[model samples]
Target: MTSSLHLPRRRRGLNRRQALAALGAACALAPGAADATPEAARKLLGDLVKVAPKAGKVKIDVPEIAENGNAVPVTVTVDSPMSPTDYVRAIHIIADRNPQPGVASFMLGPDNGKAEVQLRMRMAESQNVIVVAELSDGTAWTATREVKVTVGGCST
Candidate 1:
């Protein structure tokens, strides 16, 4: 018996090459398929803070090689007095290669009594993770660490 699923060559939607090309184009244009760049991560930080963040005073504690990108442990600490006048106002975690560069943002105050933030972040691939700490005085500090992921977890 002839199968109804079978279609003649003339009735085929696209040839082999055309089908492949269409697939490639679709993958390229797919949402969340594009990975974020380091420049984009930096631009996100720039948009958050007016002044250029200087390196140091902020420490990023993360594994040099993350076994899995699904949940990579990260700890960000800022050297601050934690006083009412001078304290860390915010801490932003950014994964450069993720679909979304901004991972998490923690808002802190003197009452928190510490300038440390710990969380698990999803990394798209092997790339830099940037941590920016903004102080109450409008000063910003940054720290970057490279984490190599064996298995990428992000949709990108």
Candidate 2:
């Protein structure tokens, strides 16, 4: 007696190279995959920092070398008087090498007490990461740091 459950046959006709090419095409067409490139980060930064004149008093802290790319710590600080009159409105973090370069964005208010942010994110390789801050007065400030990643975490 033969089992009715028959598994699908593997495509032995396709060579390794062809299979790899097909996989690459599929990955490129996948939603969110194509947008996970460094270019996306650039676009995001440009949109967030539209009015360059407003950018000032922003600071970023990043390690020179990240031992692990899976979780690198980042810190951002802004010089502002956390009051209703003048306060940090938001902070944006972008990693150049990561698949999703747009790491995080934090929205702040006067109640935050201070214009500071800290978080951990994944890095794909060695590249510049930018941090931008926006204030209630419609001013923006940015800082960048080059982070070296020993092992890439975005890709296998």
Taken over the whole model, the C-alpha lDDT of each candidate is 0.83, 0.78
Distance from true location, Cα of 120 in model 1, Å = 0.4
**Model 1 compared with the native: what TM-score?**
0.79
The collision pairs in model 1 are none
How many collisions per candidate?
Answer: 0, 5
lDDT for 85 in candidate 2 is: 95
Q: For model 2, name the residue pairs that clash.
A: 54-140, 55-140, 55-141, 56-140, 56-141
Residue 156, candidate 1: alpha-carbon lDDT? 40
lDDT of 2 by residue, 65-134 (tens): 9988888888889998999999989898887755566888899999999999889888767788888888
Q: How close to the true structure is residue 104 of candidate 2, measured as C-alpha lDDT?
A: 86
Candidate 1: list runs displaced more than 4 Å: 1-30
Per-residue C-alpha lDDT of model 1 across residues 43-151, encoded as one tens digit per residue: 8888887789999999999999999888899988899999999999999888787766888889999999989888988876798988888999998999899889987
Q: Give the worst 10-residue stretch by lDDT in candidate 1.
A: 1-10
Best by TM-score: 1
